[model samples]
Target: MHDVIGLVLAAGAGRRLRPYTDELPKALIPVDGDTTILDIALANLAASDLREVAVVVGYKSNAVEERREALERRHGVRLTLVHNDKAEVWNNAYSLWTAREVMSEGALLVNGDTVHPVSVEQTLLQYRQQEGSEDIVLALDTAKVLAEEEMKVVTDERGHMRRITKLMDPSEASGEYIGATLIEGAAVPALAEALQATFERDPQLYYEDGYQELVNRGGTVGTAPIAAGTSWVEVDDHRDLERARTIACRY
Candidate 1:
């Protein structure tokens, strides 16, 4: 595999996170005793040899950018920061659009507010093995107990995505879509076209909508089912932050 670029989408306002997000962006929210959510994310990626990172920032972009720079200086890995001016109006699909040029090809995409166990590297490696055959490789937490608010995924026996449903009924859902994906360079143009169409229709559509569109268009979107042993969390609310803190402190 060629040198892979990494895109970290950190632009959402994270309204569900509430008072915790009242001051800083979700990416900068302290998950552990001192480590911010973004810090742990970058550290995990760096550990996986997934370098050349670019972070898309919004909602207190200055603080996120400053912290990103400081973390890069300390970690010895350069981080590129991209601004998402439409963060308030658009969803993470726009955040990914902002980093179109940041990654050339063979890139990995992840959400900044999420933290997963070291197993994420292996998930990426799984995609590397498939390469150009798949348009997108999405990570799924197969063991998560589905709640009403979380996005859910349904897949065929072969792990191909059947359909992505949001706010799905927990009783009927199969697994959760962790906000991480790998898209090859060949798929970028088609993905871009779908995103543009989505924006034209509704600029505020969620990133999952775009991925679902790819599935609708016969694009090959595969799933990597992370076993129950792997740790993954998205620090969107105070409770989630505390949960992540507990895990991070232990890790």
Candidate 2:
């Protein structure tokens, strides 16, 4: 197995979250009592046996810096903060590109704002160990009822991703591409180039667009379906935060 690192993209300003994100980045917002979104992300990575974790911080990054020690102790993992200088002005495609160095060593990437159980990480890693696994494996919520806002994916019969975007019709999607990915070290260079192209094309584009870019360039991206009844929430707004709180405690 590759020496994979844990990567979390926590740089988004999450403007829609308003008051909660006014001072803190979306990742710092609390879900469970005293346990913030970043806390859950770290906990899940640690539970998956990832000893080294890199968090890309930008908006209100000092908040994460201040809690670095405490979070490391709580999660039993070493923390590395990768700063995204343009976090406030750019989108997550740039945020993800900022972690290219770490990604070069292989990484299990997770969205900081997402609250999920360790099973998601475990599933990705498990899929990586299987024969015929693709270079990049994305966690897909095949059972979720996708909406326009959710990042959607279309796949071939062999489970290779054909397309990924938020603009596709929901009924045409195979599932929602939850904010988790297993990236092999070998794919980093191509992925970095793809990401750079994606952001340069449109700074507002999401990192999922980079995945599409990679696919367009003939890169093979595969999927791992999250187990049925698995609970997860991408805390983008107050309503999502409330849903996160409801399920976070269960994990």
TM-scores for the candidates: 0.92, 0.99
Candidate 1 Cα errors over 4 Å, as ranges: 130-133
Cα displacement (angstroms), candidate 2, residue 100, comes to 0.4
**Which candidate tops TM-score?**
2
- lDDT, residue 210, model 1: 78
- Model 2 per-residue lDDT tens digits across residues 107-171: 99999899999999999999977988988999999998888889999999999999999898999
TM-score of 1: 0.92
lDDT for model 2: 0.93
After TM-score superposition, the amount by which residue 247's alpha carbon in candidate 2 deviates from its true location, in angstroms, is 0.4
lDDT scores of the candidates, listed in order: 0.77, 0.93
